[model samples]
Target: MEDTTQLLPILAVHFHNDLGLATANTLAGIYVGVRQVDVTINGIGERAGNASLEEIVMAIKCRGEEVLGGVYTGINTKHIFTTSNMISKIRKSTKNITDGILKNKGTYEFVSAEDVGFIRASEHGIRLGKLSGRHALKIKILELGYNFEEKQLEDLFWRFKSMAGRKKNITDDDLRALILDETIVPQIA
Candidate 1:
């Protein structure tokens, strides 16, 4: 790989997640001074998928200072979840269209919702659901850049449960709306 880098202007590493080591291999390449890596959002790709962009970015952001000698990507980590959601929705829509043409509900659906970061916080190792505890909610809230007081979190949790009862899945958008509604102060006219 070192000799190959000298031959080319750019030595980008592209690895498939067939053995589920694409992210690790990508980081390995980066460690060896390869700056470019091919990655997909939510790791969705052909076959077993590709290296996860979020995983690589977060790994570098969290450990670059101490472990990787300050190697970092310019990715905005805050948009990771939203980008995953958008990709998941697009994939789902494409699956729906292909399913209609193929006359099979899952003919074009290769990845699971959880695999695409839908209804599950795989990075955090927590599955959000109606039965999720306050700790889980608090973690998600903090991840979304909201720092509510203890009492507010408690109140929000109850409201979350109320909304959760009606919906099969409460997405980040739902949570944001719930937070906004719960925290908004009404004024006297």
Candidate 2:
């Protein structure tokens, strides 16, 4: 590989993820002095797809300086998430590219959402379901600008439990509706 790089100084390596080794192979090429790499957004290709731009870029960004002998790419890491999301949208795939981004950005992600042009939505992180507890409900209620006493919170918890049993997931809008429906004083006819 070094000999080939010496011969063709401007050579670029193309990788296919047939056996899920494209990113690994591409990194190997870089280690062997390959100057360029070929990758596609979301790893979309004919069969098993090519090297994923996100995987490769993030791998380099996170490991290049420390592990890959100081080798690095000129990629803007912040545009990665946005680019992946755009490609997913264009391909009409059902995958939520930024779903992980909405939660704790560091769990499965090594980079920041802002680094990849992704603005995390405020309401996107509130995932309420039947399994959610009183604390979660109280937090969501507070986020919606509602303050309730301990007694009120207990009442809301029961109502939320009943509502959650009847629904698959409780959304922010639904939570707002529940608060209004229960709190509003009706005018006597």
Candidate 3:
């Protein structure tokens, strides 16, 4: 065992959902000056699970941003969804992980592994809307930007509701283009 103060470069903690180690592992990383973090989405681990990529990234964004001295996250907020898709494709290809949501299409779109940078194969994490208002708005805003006002959002909401009972009624294909546009931020020089 090494002193956590020295910040040993190599430390692998098994993930277990019994205690929610995902959040714990991320905080541990912060406890130590870890530049490179190891994480997976949904905390898929050998036994219980490992830390979640979203948890780590969100923690970094919440705590590391503008603080933690020289700590700077290497994730692009806008590309998060696409990146998750790419990671999923890679995992599927490698047989490391399973695609749980590929069954759902049209309503949303996901990227392929090549879309990210997974030349090799490995298991990774994915992010999605988790029944939270923020998640829904994030999915929308990620694709469409802030162009849609409250009224338009309300309209879309009502439209979704109107089609709620229909077998198939999401005829709005324009939203896909918006999702694709959820990339780099505008250069503000």
Candidate 4:
């Protein structure tokens, strides 16, 4: 079908993922000069779903220059993560969310989350434990938009130490509560 449509002025491919081949078929269509592709976020569609917008777009982005003769979409890839999250929330499908991209995007993600308008917070990987240092607490405090004096940070550190004893890990939410309840530092914004 793609071969026959190559000579047409406008070519579009509508694919289904019944065999998990929607993305593959879409790529094949593009290679054959298909100008338009039908895709959905997270591949949500009838039955097995359609070609995923993320997968298709990222494929073109990562391979278009080398393989597709520089063919590329005008999409702002950074918003990809934000858009995916919005769609997932709307559909109540949180199972698809993963932090693999957050740690190191290039490992499993083909695109950067920042390109899609999502800003990863500094507290993402910080795990507060009994061995955590005062410097670590200070960094986390600043990252959370708080500016505290040395004395205040010391007080909070002790409070954190007490809490860490009870809980194996102190989460960001817990840290936020400690800052709010114990410290007089004003939130940056």
Top candidate (lDDT)? 4
Q: What is the lDDT for 80 in model 4? A: 88
Candidate 4 achieves a global lDDT of: 0.80
Backbone clash total, candidate 1? 0
TM-score of each: 0.50, 0.63, 0.40, 0.59
Evaluate candidate 2 by giving its C-alpha RMSD to the native, one decimal: 6.0
Residue pairs in collision within model 1: none
| Model 4 misplaced regions, further than 4 Å | 1-7, 95-105, 123-173, 176-189
lDDT scores for all predictions? 0.74, 0.78, 0.49, 0.80
Over 1-189, each residue of candidate 1 has an lDDT whose tens digit, in order, gives 367756766669999999989999998888877878899888888999999887888788777778776888887666666787688888883222112212332454343334333453433544457867787788778877788999989999999988888887778888999989987899899
- Cα-based lDDT at residue 182, candidate 4: 78
Clashing pairs in 2: 78-115, 78-116, 79-116
Ranking by lDDT: 4, 2, 1, 3
Decreasing TM-score order of the candidates: 2, 4, 1, 3
lDDT-wise, the better of 2 and 3 is 2
**RMSD vs true structure, all candidates:** 13.3, 6.0, 14.2, 8.8
Question: What local lDDT score does residue 58 receive in model 2, on the 0 to 100 scale?
Answer: 81
